[model samples]
Target: MLSPSPNSIKKAFSRVALVGKYQADGMQEHLGDLAKLLGQQGCEIFIEASTAAHLSLTAYPTKKIETFAGAIDLAVVLGGDGTMLGIGRQLAGSQVPLVGINMGRLGYMTDIPIQSVQTILPQIIAGEYEADTRTLLAAVVLRNGEEINRSLALNDVVVNRSGISGMVGLAVKVNGSFMYNLRSDGLIISTPTGSTAYALSAGGPILHPRVAGILLAPIAPHSLSNRPIVLPQDIMVSIEVVDGREIIVNFDMQSQTHLQTGDTIQVRQSEKTITLLHPRAHSDYKTLREKLHWNEYPSTF
Candidate 1:
C-alpha cells in the first residue's frame, strides 16, 4: 500500500490521462463524450498518440505511451482488465495510480461503471479515493545463457506447451530449494492480486491484496495430488523448461516468445508496484462473491 505523505493531499491532480480499449465494443463515441466531460471540468486529458489517431479526435490531443508517465497525474482506463494491463506496462516503473472503468464483463480490476465517471471524476481529482498497491512479478527468460525476453506482470507468468497435445514438464524451485517436477499443461506464478484470475481456475486460493506472498499452481497437473502452493513474497521462484519440443512463455495476457528446450525463467517480486485507485468502501470479499458467483457454503440465515 502507498503511504500518504504530508504532501499527498497537495499532490492532488488537475491533469489526467484517458486510456481505453482501442477498437473496444461500443466505446469510441463514449470516449469523445468522456473527454468532453473531463475537459468541461478543467481537467487536461492525455491520451496515447495511437489512440488519438485511431479515434481521429482533434480536441483531445495525445502523447506517446512513453511520454504519458511524466505528463499525467492519474490514468483513467476505460475498458476491462486487459486495457489496464496494457497501460500498466507503459506506466510500470513510474508508480502511476490507475483507475479502471469497466466497459466489459468480468472486470475484476476495472470496477467503475461508465455512467459513474462524471460523478466520481471530481472526487478522484480531489484525492478522495484509496490506493491499493499491487505487487508485480518480473521474469527473465534465458536460452543458452542468453537473455531472450524480460517482462513484468500484474498477473501471472506462465510457461506451457504451444498448441501441443502433450503435457509439458516444468521444474520448479523456490528460494533455491527444490519444490517439484510437474507434468501439466503449464505453470502459473502469480501474486495475491492475481489469485482470482487464472490461478483460481487452477484450484489456487483467492488471496487478500494485503497478503505478501505468491501462488504457484500447475495447470491441469497430470498428478491429481499436485496442488497450489503459497510462498513468502521475498523468495524467488524459478521454472525450467524440462521437456517438450515446443513451448511458450507468457506474461499476463501477452505471450513473450516460443521457447526451445534448455530455456529457464526466473520469477521474483518486482521492486515496482501498480497503484490501483479504488472507491473508499471497496471490499475484496464482496467483489469475489458477486463477480465470481462464489456462493457461501452455508448462509448465516
Candidate 2:
C-alpha cells in the first residue's frame, strides 16, 4: 500500500477535469449540474471537447481527450464503469487521481453513486478522501505473427466469439507452460478489482482489492471440471485462439477488436496504476454483501 503525503495533497488545486459519457443516457443533465457546482467552487474546470455540449457552462475550457491529463489536478468521471475505464486509460501514464460517479447499472469501477457526488465532491477537493491504488492489465493481440491492437484494462480482458450461438475454444498458458484448452463461451482474465465484474458473473470468486493476484475464469465451460483459478500477479498469461469461427477481445468493456485464428494474447500486470478515492469508512467486503445481496437469508434473531 502507498502512503499518502499530507504535504503533497494540502497544496491548492487550481484545475479539475470533468469526464463524462457524451452520448450516454442522462449525461448532459448530470454533467451540467456538476460543471455548475464545480465552477462555483472557484476551480478552473476542464472538460473533453466532445463532452462540451453536455455542460451548460460555456466559460470552462474544453480540450481533446489526449490533452486531459496535462490540464487537470483531479479527474471526476461522471458515468458508469465504461466512463471510468475510458478516463482511466487516458490518465494511466499520469499521476492524476480519479473519482468516479456512477451513472450506469452495476458500476464496480465507477463505485461512487451520482446522488452522493454533491456531498462527496467538497470532501474530495479538500483532500479528505483516501486513495486506493488499483492495478491494470495490458493486453496485446498477435494475429498471424503481427501485432493487431494493444490496449489496457482496469477490469478484466476477455476473449470471446462475436456471435451469440457458438462456444469458443481458448488454450491457456502461463509463463510458457501449458494450462488447459477450455471449451467455453469465453475466458476472463480479471484483476482483483475486476473479480466482481464479468469474472464473478462467470462463477469466479470475489477477490479483495489489496490481494496481488489474477483470475482466470472460463465462461460457461462445456465441461464442469474447467473452473476459475487465481494466479500470482507477477506471472505472465497468454491465451491462444484454439477453435472458433470468429473471436473478439473486450478491454474493460470499453474497446472491442476482432481476432483471427492462431492469435496469441499476452496478458500481464500493467506498470501503470490507477488511483481511486475511497471514503475513510468504505469497506470492500461490505460493498460485496450490499451489492450482491448475499446475506438475504431469513434468520430468527
- How many clashes in each candidate? 0, 0
Per-residue lDDT of candidate 1, residues 1-301 (tens digit): 9855433433366677777787886667878877776666567777767777776766767877777666777888888888887777668878568898986464778888777778876677777788888888999998899998899998889887767558998889887898899999999899887898889998999989889998998999999988998999999998888897677888996757788777889999999887899777877777788787777566874
| Model 2 lDDT tens row, 1-301 | 8765433344345588787877777887787788777765666778777678655546677877677666778888888777787778778878888888887454666677887778777677776787888999999999887899899988889988776648888889999999988998899999998998889989999989889999998988999999899999999999999888778889988788888778899999999998888666767766776689876877763
TM-score of each: 0.91, 0.88
Q: What is candidate 1's CA lDDT for residue 173?
A: 88
Residue runs of model 2 more than 4 Å from their true location after superposition? 1-12, 24-26, 53-57, 104-106, 295-301
lDDT minimum window of 10 residues, candidate 1: 3-12
